[model samples]
Target: MADKCHMCLLGLIILCPLLTGMNGAETTHVFCSSGENVHLPCNIALSGCTSTTWNYNRHSSAVEMVSGGKKKNDIERHERLSLGSDCSLNIKNTKEDYGSYSCIQYVNGQQQGTDAHVHLHVLHGQCFCKSHV
Candidate 1:
């Protein structure tokens, strides 16, 4: 009985930090559009990220990104800018592609954060330059 109790306690001790995720980096939604271009931003909670992945499932492949700087890799090879702690994704213009987006991060060694999901809503309109009357 004592051996079993000790084993259980040991298991908990080994798994506590991994589950708690000590000061891990985080990915949050900045702003995203439907018909227009969408931008996704991410902020690092901690500076212990050896590496990470910026995931947009709708896109063909996942982006292997390194922490400590800005990221600007769009879905369709856009030449815009993604900026720091801000991983933006532009969907161009589409109604069928209006859905959710995620930027899953594999921090430290274990899969810690994967819950940042952005929803898309398509719109139709035209904006022309206008001067004050």
Candidate 2:
């Protein structure tokens, strides 16, 4: 009976948003078979939050994708990765697009919350190669 209840709870967790609204977690992960999808979690005080932005630094062959937005000044990285307002780092499928990522959140023109960390790991191709051996 306990195991059944635990499973029910897990189901609820995955289905609650579908039944209710588009709610998101304070933290999330993005798994990639060939690439990585990064979700940078951030928050600011409700009283002072006006605008929010994301900043990330990527060095794949020692390159910059995003330095900083118009509001802030920072170094830029390579073009292999893309970023969005939700703080989503969308990287194109590339073997070299794997490394440490620094995620920053800005609110009301002030840095707040924390600097999130994300790491990308590249894996071998399909396991079919092993089967042939």
Candidate 3:
């Protein structure tokens, strides 16, 4: 019985930090309309990041959007993809851009901050017109 108790304690010690780290990360969502610019706020300052990456679609092949200062590279780079002064992601609104976007921040290439998960929901647009009788 004592041996089993010791093993359990050891297991908890090993796993405690892992669990805490995962809990430290956060996930949030945002909604946007098609044909409008959307800001997925990370709220982490640019000065705080040595590296920053945005990932799209949590389950599918994760598409990475890179940005740091004026340097950015990725498919969405041409479409006015930008990071705000506060490190929020600004995406030129489109139906294709609707999905889960995750912002992972790093200091000196070590993940050490709250992660952001922004869900971009693009509402289907409609036009209303009055009938002239």
Candidate 4:
């Protein structure tokens, strides 16, 4: 009985740090209006964007927007996409850009850290008209 209790206590101590580190990787929410420009932030900050990659997922499939610090021109919305100096993914005139954006970092062709997730919510503006008699 004594040996079992000792092993359980040791296991908790070793797993505590690993569980705490998982909290650092969290999802961020960004809200924007239609026809407006928006930037999705990356949680991890590195020296340069040479190892950064951005992907967008609207419903099922994910499309790569920026890879290796360069924008992919073959994408549908390539003209409206740009990468910021700090590895952020920027979109111009966001109309159908409401989706999930992920920022991943790599080094030496291998992924370095966990992916940073950003959820974009697009809100359309409404107009209210009043009539006076």
Return the TM-score for each candidate structure.
0.39, 0.43, 0.63, 0.74
lDDT of 1 by residue, 1-133 (tens): 5456445445544554454323352223222223455544344323432343444444454443323233444434434424333343344444355434454455545665454444343333332111110
Q: Write the per-residue lDDT of candidate 3 for residues 15-130, one digit (tens) a residue.
A: 54454334455445454446677777775555744477777774577877755433355475545787777777777745567777777777666775666766565544431111
- The local distance difference test score of each candidate is 0.39, 0.41, 0.59, 0.74
When sorted by TM-score, best at the front, the candidate numbers are 4, 3, 2, 1
* TM-score top scorer: 4
Cα deviation at 89, candidate 2, in Å, is: 0.9
Backbone atom clashes (below 3 Å) for every candidate: 1, 6, 0, 0
Tell me which residue pairs clash in candidate 1: 40-88
Name the weakest run of 10 consecutive residues (lDDT summed) in model 4. 124-133
Candidate 4 ranges with C-alpha deviation above 4 Å: 1-25, 126-133
For model 4, give the RMSD to the true fold.
16.3
Error of 2 at 128 (Å): 13
| RMSD of candidates 1 onward, in order | 18.0, 12.3, 16.5, 16.3
How does residue 42 of candidate 1 score in lDDT? 40
Report the Cα lDDT for candidate 4.
0.74
